[model samples]
Target: MTAGEDISVRRKKLRYRAWHRGTREMDLVLGPFADAHVESYDHAALDRLEALMSEEDPPLLKWVMGQETPPDNVDLAFLELVIADHHARLAK
Candidate 1:
């Protein structure tokens, strides 16, 4: 219904696993929250995520691969939550 919700739905439709073989690739493409678990995301959420991830060091690629955790940033946490929700929905 919302922009975030829309992104999540689209992500679910994508062949995420195929596109991202493991956490390494996921992190590079999706960022730290790549492994967080997204269930219902929308465009706005993704845009926010991109903005947040882009500003991080190691390119968030390392984080998604379990190499590290993002700094304590409110925006990052919020994006992670959205990504996690979308991942959950895709699992179903």
Candidate 2:
């Protein structure tokens, strides 16, 4: 989150960004993930989610979809959560 930003504001912004990514496919992936889980996320998790969303759409989408492994610098733990969330969503 940016300097002086309230945590609630940060979460709202993250949700908006997730749902409004330029690509519709990305919107579908990240939007629901943020909606389902962002309320329970702590500051560190929010930081990780923001980091994950910072990645470019194509590479990020590939990673989330398991089409490619994320690099070491990526937030692996959070990515795992998102992947699990995504699959759980699919199962439903």
Candidate 3:
């Protein structure tokens, strides 16, 4: 994206990517989360999420589903936030 690009455009792009992930499981996991939070996220959070999105779907599914933990080198705080939010929605 152009340096002139700002949050709104970046957010829209994020939402689009989340919804269009090649796997249906990924789309379901990420699309709603992005819709709910991307617009409100700080640049640093967005940067983290964007980096996360570059990862393959299988590992993300494992992490989000709690079948496997995120790696030690990865950031956990934000991932926990997302996983907790996802689980909360499921509980509702």
Candidate 1, position 13, lDDT: 40
Per-residue lDDT tens digits for candidate 3, residues 1-92, read 66446788999999999999899988987888899999888789899889778878999889999899888866788778778878877888
Tens digit per residue, CA lDDT, model 1, 15-55: 25424535454434453244444444456665555555445
Q: How accurate is candidate 1 locally (lDDT)?
A: 0.51
Global lDDT of each model? Answer: 0.51, 0.90, 0.85
* Residue ranges of candidate 2 with Cα displaced over 4 Å: 1-5
lDDT per residue as tens, model 2, 1-92: 56546788988999999999999988988999999988888898899999999999998889988899999999898889888988898899
Winner by TM-score: 2
Model 3: number of backbone collisions: 0
TM-score of every model? 0.34, 0.89, 0.86
Quality of model 3 by C-alpha lDDT: 0.85
